[model samples]
Structure formats: structure tokens, C-alpha cells
Target: MTIFGEIAQITLRALLGRRRTLLMLLLAAIPILVGLLVRANARPGPVDVGAFLDAIVIRVVLPLVALVFGTAALGSELEDGTAVHVLTKPIRRSTIVLAKITVAGTLTAALLVPSTIVAGMLIAGLLNTRPGSDPITATFAIGLGVLVGSYLYAAIFVALSIVTSRGLLVGLGYALIWEGILAGLLPGSQVFSVREYVRGIAETLEPSSIESIVGSSAVAYAAIALVTASVIASLRLAVYEVRGGE
Candidate 1:
């Protein structure tokens, strides 16, 4: 019925943009490839989850995907001035924000779960190849962590895309500086880090299989704060103006 509504509809469609579509595929493939590599080298049994999660998910994949999808959901459109075309309508800005968030969040979650599972299976196979560790639980634990963590991170970044033009650059700083450095090196910062919560949830879900980086309650609160703030902030930042959001 309106410009935002029509464009929102386009973005919501699975095949709205080819560039974003290809990026999503590449993102999904990373985890799967890692899983295959691990499995090929060993057997799918018990996995060395700490090393795997730290190196694969935390160190590399998650942040990169967050940067790409989060920015692409809104930043790219803003940069290209395409956002102006849509905002020229009668639709509520809140609806447009929600639509963008939905697109980015869905892409992250849908791709992350399967990739984590595949990787976990491979790592587990390797650890159990010698017949000592419990590999079966590894897959479930990692998959569980991937699911919620992806959702949390995606939502946070999707909202972030609104506040900054350099979405990927800022997201990189968020991942490397906040999540990677400060959270890892300082216990004090852990209280405020989103990853702290993800690590906690992952541990809670994996209970016997993995040890979380922080306490459960702390992580729970941090996760909720990140998600809620992202949504609320994005809503407030909405500029109903048709041009430059001015």
C-alpha cells in the first residue's frame, strides 16, 4: 500500500536481492566446510569443544557473518540511497525497522544452526575416533549454543546497522574489541559482554559437555539487555523523513 510497505515486502522475499542471497550461502558454507574438514581428518565421535568453539565460532565465523548480514540488512540500502525510495510512503517507520530486522535475523539463524551441527558432528567424530570421549553430546551442545547465540548477535547487529553507516567496521570493532579482547582478557568486562551471555547459555545447554565462560545469571541478563536495547534503540532512531532520514 505504501513505499516502505512495498519495499519491505521485497526485502522479506527470499530472493529479493542476489548479492545478499549469495552472501548468505557463503556464510552458511563456512561452518559446514569446517565440519567436513574436521570429520575427514578424524572420526565423528567426541569433539574438543573448547578449541572448536573458540577457534571456529568465536574467533572467525560468527563475527564475520554478523558484520555481513547485519550491515547488508540496512546499511547497504542506506549507502546506496535506496532507503529513501521506500521511506517516501505512508507506512510506519517501526514496521520498516521490524522488517529489516526480521530479514537479517532470519538469515543468521537459519544458516547457523545446520552449520554448527555439521561442524560438531565432525569434531565429535575426531575426538571419539580413539574411543575415549563422549562425542554424541558435543553436536547437540554446539548446535544449541549456535542457535540462541546467532539470534542474539543477529538482532543486536541488525539494529546497529541503523545507527551507523560503517556497519561492518563498527561490527568488527564490536566483535574484536568487545567480544574478543575485553571480554576474554578481563573478567570485569565479561559482566557487560554479549558473548559472556552466549558462552553462559552454551554452557548451560551443554551442562556436562562444556564449561561456560561466565555465571548463568550474568549471561542471561546480558543477553536480554543486548536484544532488547537493539530493538528499542532501533525503534527510537527511526527517522520518518523520506530523505537522509533527516
Candidate 2:
């Protein structure tokens, strides 16, 4: 196996072999459960389903999941002093950081994508809800949006792990306070919010129906540029920290 593959395997094991994994699984299931409840309560239309997904899955669950997995990907290793052993290897620090963030991002996507799809599909069925667009297409688009957001969040939180041992606390604060509250209240701050990026991507995909609820003003190219920049900057910071420890 390649060095990146080896590091990713170790990261996967480290992340999955914990009680927190179970908690994350439960967390991922929350949207599906809520979808079931919504279906039971009332026959919600496409717009309502889109709004529910935007409010619950995109805004709340995605960040929380990414925060947990992303920080734990490297944070636990550093805290337990196991990362020093990996650092001692004849491997590039960039490779280590890349592998760690990739694993973290992929895991976050894997858990949330299906959850988002199922919840959206359950709330808005495979049938066409309107003339041009369908809930199924919008649902899959949102799932892809979650996939994009997961990697961005993972990269940011992985770098946070390197910068501080309190990565979880710091990430949680950023998600809940900065992105959740400040971004909502201060419209200009939406430029710095990953939630807004996700909304932008999703709105771009299913523009006709989801635009009203997702309410993102960011253009697709700008959102892509911001996400790409964040990921590169995050990986650079993580690599620098790892190399500085040498």
C-alpha cells in the first residue's frame, strides 16, 4: 500500500474503534428519524422538505458530524502521543496531513450523504413535486452538497486539531456560534461560513425549487473558490504544524 493509504487505514481504525463512533452513528440517524416524524405528522411538499433539510441536516447535523470525526482523526492520536510514532516514519508531513483529512472527510460524507438522501426522499418522494424539478433530484443535490461541505469542514477541523488540543471545543464554537448564529444575523459573515457554502452548492444544483428555502446568495464559482482555498490553507497549516514538531 502507498504511504497515504497506510496513514488513512490507521486513521480509519483510530476513528472507528471508539465509543464516539456509536454516538456519531446515532447522530447521523437523527435526520432519518425526524423525516419519519414529519411524514407521519403531515404530507409535506417539496419546498417544506427542502426547508426541513436546510434547517436540520445542512445547518445542524453536517457540521457536528464533521467536527467530531475531523478532530478525532488526528486529535486523538496527538493526545495519546501516537502521532509522534507516525511522525518518526520516513513519510512526508503533507502526506500524513492529507491522509488524515481525506479519511476524516470521506467518513463524514459517507455517514451524512445517505442520511440526507433518505431523509429528503422520505419527506419528498421520488415523484415530481412540481413541473420542471422533482424532490429526488433536489434530494440528491443536497446530498452532494453535504459531501462538499464534509470535506471542507474536515480540512478546517483537522487544521484546528493541529493548532490546539481543544479542537472539538473550538470547532463546536465556530459551528454553533460563528456559522450558526453570527452568519445568520450578520449577512456579510456568510462569506466565511461553510453552511452557506453548502447552501450555495445545493442551490446551484436545484435552483428552481430549493433556492427559496436554502436562501444562499453566493455564486457557485465563488463558493467553489472559497471552499478550495479553505481546504488548501487548512492542509498547509496542518502540514506546517506536523513538520514543526519534527
Candidate 3:
């Protein structure tokens, strides 16, 4: 437990450096800032604020931030050879992977959820009449969905980081091309999409307000995928050949 705590602490410090922390704050604040500006400036009329928020926050911002933090958690260490010392420690590799996952997931959620809730509230307020889902329900749904997405995405990216130096770029391609475009366009792709898992949860809570292609049943697959990725990551790191620093 102590070892895990140390790894988590180190991971947090590495991932949350001054510039990166500022970037995360700015990324999270995107939705809130945009929502406030819209609320203040846009003329009063019937608008689908929920859908707009969904597109911007869920589809775009959430994944981008997750990619950044997730890759940074371990990928940076691997690239810079700082992880060699940690790898040589008398600790289980799974512990290291778990710690990285925990920190990355927590950090991503912390950065994302508040902005989502605030943006949801602002959008809910803008609407003169409530929709199928109440503001509270919608806010909860978005927060929950983003939380789930952040954890799952972070786990996958952390694993990718161990396997490849270009994990961030690969994650970006997957997020933009695979999950973002394919999942929406190809029904078959929904089965393998993390976004669908997130949408499934949100839609289960507020089916009308949240747009989802797959039903709640798919959430199990998402969980399984997350676990599989973590396990694979641990195994990879356990036997990883760390070389001298560059």
C-alpha cells in the first residue's frame, strides 16, 4: 500500500506540473467559459443547450484532456527513462500500473466533472422550459458519463503509453477517427467504443436528453475492456526492458 501511495504521489507530481496543470484547468474551463458566453450573449429562444454541451464537452473536450493526462501518467516516464528506477524497485508491476491508472483517472475526473456540472447548470438555466430530463438529472448524467469516460480512456491510454512511444498520437487518432467518427457513423463500431459506454450510462439516466446508440447492456463490455487494458499494461511493464537515459 505504501509503495502504491508513493507511486501515485510521484505520478501526480509528474502529471500535474505547473504548465500542464494550467493547461488542464484551461481545458476544463472551456465548456464553462463557452456556456457563460453563450448564456450572456445569445438571444432568448428555444435552444438545445443540452445537445450543444454534449457535442462540445463529451465528444471533444473530455477525450482530449483524458488523452493528455493519461499519456503523461506513464508515457512520459517511459520516454524519459525515469521509470527505470521505479521499475527496478522491489514492487509488483501491477502496483505501478494501478497507481498510474488511479492518478490519471482521478486527475482527469477532477478536471472534467466540475466544468461539466457548471456548464450543465448554465445550460439548464438558459432553457425557459425543462426538457425530458431535469437540470439535476442532466447534470448528473453528464458528470457520471464524463467520469466513466475519463477512467476508461485514461486506462487505455496508459497501457498504450507502455507499448508505444507515440501513444498520444495513437490515442488522438483513435479518439478522433475511431471513437468520434466511426462510432457515430458505423453501428458495428459501437460495440468497441468507450464513448458508447459513456453514452449508454448517460442515456440510461436520461434517455431523452442523452444520445446513445447502444443500450445499457454495453456498459459491461466497457468495464471488461478497462480491466483488460490495465492487466495488459501491468504485464507489459513487469517485463519491460528499460534502457539507459537519453
Off by over 4 Å in 3: 244-246
Q: Residues 1-246, candidate 3: write the lDDT tens digits.
A: 599999999899999899999988999999999889878876766556457667878888888999999999999999898988898779999999999999999999998888998987887777553444576677778688888888999999999999888999999999999987877787687878887787787877777557777767657877898899999999998878776637
In candidate 2, position 17 carries an lDDT of 70
For each candidate, the alpha-carbon lDDT, in order, equals 0.65, 0.79, 0.84
Candidate 1: worst-modelled 10 consecutive residues by lDDT = 237-246
TM-score of 2: 0.86
lDDT of 2 by residue, 1-246 (tens): 999899999899989976878998999999999988877766334345567788888889999999999899987788877888887788766778778879989999999999999999887763434556667778887898889888888888887887787999999999999987888788577777888777777877877435532355544544564456456645554454443454
- The candidate with the higher lDDT, 1 or 2, is 2
Cα displacement (angstroms), candidate 1, residue 42, comes to 3.0
lDDT of 1 at 50: 49
TM-score of 3: 0.94
TM-scores for the candidates: 0.80, 0.86, 0.94
lDDT, candidate 2, equals 0.79
User: What's the CA RMSD for each of the models?
Assistant: 3.7, 3.6, 1.8
